[model samples]
Target: MLRLGNPGRRISVGLIGMTFVLSIFAGRLIQLQGLDSKVYTAKAAEQRVRPEKLPARRGAITDADGHELALTLEAREIFIDPSVVSAAKRDQVATALAAELGVQKEPIMAKLAAGGRYQQVAAAVDPTVAQRIMDRDFKGVGSKHRYRRDYPGGDLAGTLLGFVGSDGTGLSGLESTYNKLLAGRDGEQFVETGLEGQRIPMTGGTLKAPVDGGSVRLTVNRDIQWAAQKAIADQVKAVGARTGSAIVMDVQTGHLLAMANAPELDLKNWQKAPPEDWVNRSVTDVFEPGSTNKVITAAAALESGAVRPESVFSVRDNIRCADQVLRDSHPHPMERLTFSGVVATSSNVGTILAAQKVGDEKLYGMLQRFGFGVKPGSGLPGEEAGLLPDWRNWSGSQRCTVAYGQGVSVTALQTASVYQTIANGGTRVTPRIVAGTTNGEGVFTPSAPGARTRVIGERTAKEIAGMLEAAVSTDGTGNLAAIDGYRVAGKTGTAMRYDTRCQGYCGYTSTFVGFAPADKPRLVVLAVVQDPQKGHYGGEIAAPVFKKVMTFALKSKKIPPTGTRPPAVRIRAGE
Candidate 1:
């Protein structure tokens, strides 16, 4: 009897088991569709919505003449959806793309075999090359527009213009200083993507357009910059120096015309250049002003009423101060020299004696007034104020050494500003590199001129100008800085290069700072040569560079000659 009922019982048990399995499946379905539906829906939305980055166009950098120094060009990057490419056509596509892009077939094939939603095949492709690839219209392959920085002038103003990084960020120079103005705002777009990451046409969700960057117009003259660069490079090579720099400025407005450096970096491949080559030495490097600083000492003494242009001093080959002895570059007997004559001749002994009359506090104040120990307000990156210790910190010898431009240090730009002040009737003006900035709408806003500070009386500046004119005469050390048909007012500098290894002076740095048409100065130029192997004297190595650069600047600007020759000054003979 029990056997007879067993078949039906077994059937009932089988039905129950089947029902339990189906109930479990139904419960899971409800949990997925209702209980945790928001979580599942979020996952689906995440897969469909794709974010696209829209790059902003970088602004162009132009010289004063509107010549493009740095600009951007449209580029393309090729990508592939490997999963969407057919196995049979994969080899064909890889071979064709490799040939067109000049890339390795093996890598393309490997990417295709690996099978992914997205893979980069080529980057920074020329527009023409991208068009050719689009013509073929290979399945699963497409290109997106991108921006690439181009410097058409090669390295013409590399140090001043700086370079852009791979991510399109400004890395140095004006580019870095004005990065906010140059790197505009980036944009974003949201679109529905297919399974293979392809944006579906007509399915755009949201978009925010990019705002392009503003262009920067510099005060630098391209032609004058080229001339200054060429002259400095040639001089650096001729003198076998480590490096050289030259800067030309408008004496009245302090607008920089040219900031040139030797061994300039190629903007196209600046990554491979040495870090030192990337620096704008005219603003960053500091050295003693040597005789070039004599003008400052003379100005301080004259300003304090401690000395006059006609004041007399007994100058010797060497002079004792505290525990140290200061000597001239050459041997000479003790002689009486006018204060102006001492400055024009760059006599170290006489300058120290004159400085003693002014005292340390007054001298330091005068130096600060001339833009020393402070930034020149050029708005350049890494501009150094140079080192000038306080009067209270100065020892007896230190005071005299600073008077002769030994204990103090200065940048070439700062040195140029000193001469510029004298040329501007003792009024110091800030130096500026950028002339203006242009918005995307093409509206330009000119940069504000620097503030004017009176450093000396008008009469004192004229007297100093006369002395500077004498320095470029037939007898002074800076005679080589003379330019034909143009009255030159400048001073020469020869300072010992400090050696970090020995912690003392080792080599020489030759420098010259001047302005043209001494009567009515227009252009102020400063030239510096470092560690020259051929000649270490400023008159021999640096003055000629200043002359060449200044001559070109004067000519390029069409500055008419003053025609009046500078009056000859006397230096009393030794007994």
Candidate 2:
């Protein structure tokens, strides 16, 4: 050991060294406590405050009877924080997720290698499946709550009901029409978090509650709609037709009870089907009205007093009009038939003869009055207004053809509306499908009923109804449409289908529109089959389906027929 030269001098130097060291530490403490406090505090706050989305619950779609057609269910989105997952535990997590989630391990490995902080591994996972995965407690794995739309009825009212996209938006049909009413306002929330992005305990933050959407109730009857769908689908398949549609309307209210289309979209897996399946063809497709439109001519004639139900006409196989010689559907010898007989038999020559008296303007006026040449205002997606050239645009051939139910176009909806007017005793009602809506508070609001307008006199409508009833008799064309217990009134139609593929007419559009319990019509059902290969005549292919649907509607409503025999109408001059 070395001895100190001076004890007091040594002690003084040691004290100075110690004091200098203490001052350096004190200066650093002051800088940290005052100068940089705010910056550090703000950085900590930035890490603590977290913003999150609060998804609003979408509404439900129910039928007229409060049965669910579409609904939303709770789901989950499972993801992995690949960047935070330990390399040693990555394989274990991936293997666990693959086995538990039923996903391939290769994809999981790829996502891990991609090293994203928030990498989605699965979406729309069922709650049960998500719960199982969460119970594993794997590191860097998490799930967020989400919603998935479900169509409970499957394809029951598929195209008519439409579907929703993954982003919780309506894509087609009524879903698209009522999107705003169905998708309520979404909300946001702020929560405190830790540096590792963990939520803080006991920290209340700002929140905006979501407003759930309102529920929609449709006018469609589930049983009736299902029946119509089955009937039309069977007919289309039986006839080997390209497509078909069936519409059943409440005559008095014009409420569309059922709008059925063959080959409707698979609501849950709609993406796999063709886009054409998304269309409500009853409102979308338009074609020549065929003989079904002759009722408009008949209504015009009777309403104008140009012809009477008992008026006599000299019928022949063919008649000359303008530059064309129009003929009846079947070749026949010259025979005198009453006006009622002509309609009952669906004679083209007699219809043209009557049309000659009604002229173009009056006939066009009647057509318009019966809801032709315009959109039906049914609020369906892709509704076409249908082609109706102005009366002045009628060609020489079109002049005579228009008189009988050709050279003009109308949708199945328009044709149904025509029959609905006759069935509703001359008053034409606007067709509607939405019955009402329900708010989040559970208060119900009924949609306004369809508008009604008288299109013809009650006496003229009765006369036409008699003629339509005669058409369903044994001597008539639509005999197949007659139900055993009901005095049915209907018309058969076979028109040249204007094929878009060929840009011209190719196959036939077979149709039958009618109402049952004719004396007090409750329902008007229309069935249409397009481009049939097995059979083409409306009476053969379309009439039976009309009968099936009408019977079901009548039974569903408990509408017993009047049970009176149909009135006898003269079919020939000799009678």
Candidate 2 lDDT over residue span 358-457, tens digit each: 8889988888888777899888888888877889999988988887678888888889999999988899999999999988777899989888999999
Q: What is the lDDT of residue 372 in candidate 1?
A: 85
Against the reference, the lDDT scores of all candidates come to 0.89, 0.89
Candidate 1, number of clashes: 0
Clashing pairs in 1: none
Task: Give residue 158's lDDT in candidate 2 (0 to 100).
Answer: 95
Off by over 4 Å in 2: 1-42, 98-106, 192-201, 204-206
Flag clash pairs in model 2: none
Q: Give the Cα error of residue 230 in candidate 2, in Å.
A: 0.9
Best by TM-score: 2
Per residue, candidate 1 scores C-alpha lDDT tens digits across 270-380 of 989999899898899888888888888898888889898888888889988899988988899887998878988889999999998998898899889898899888889
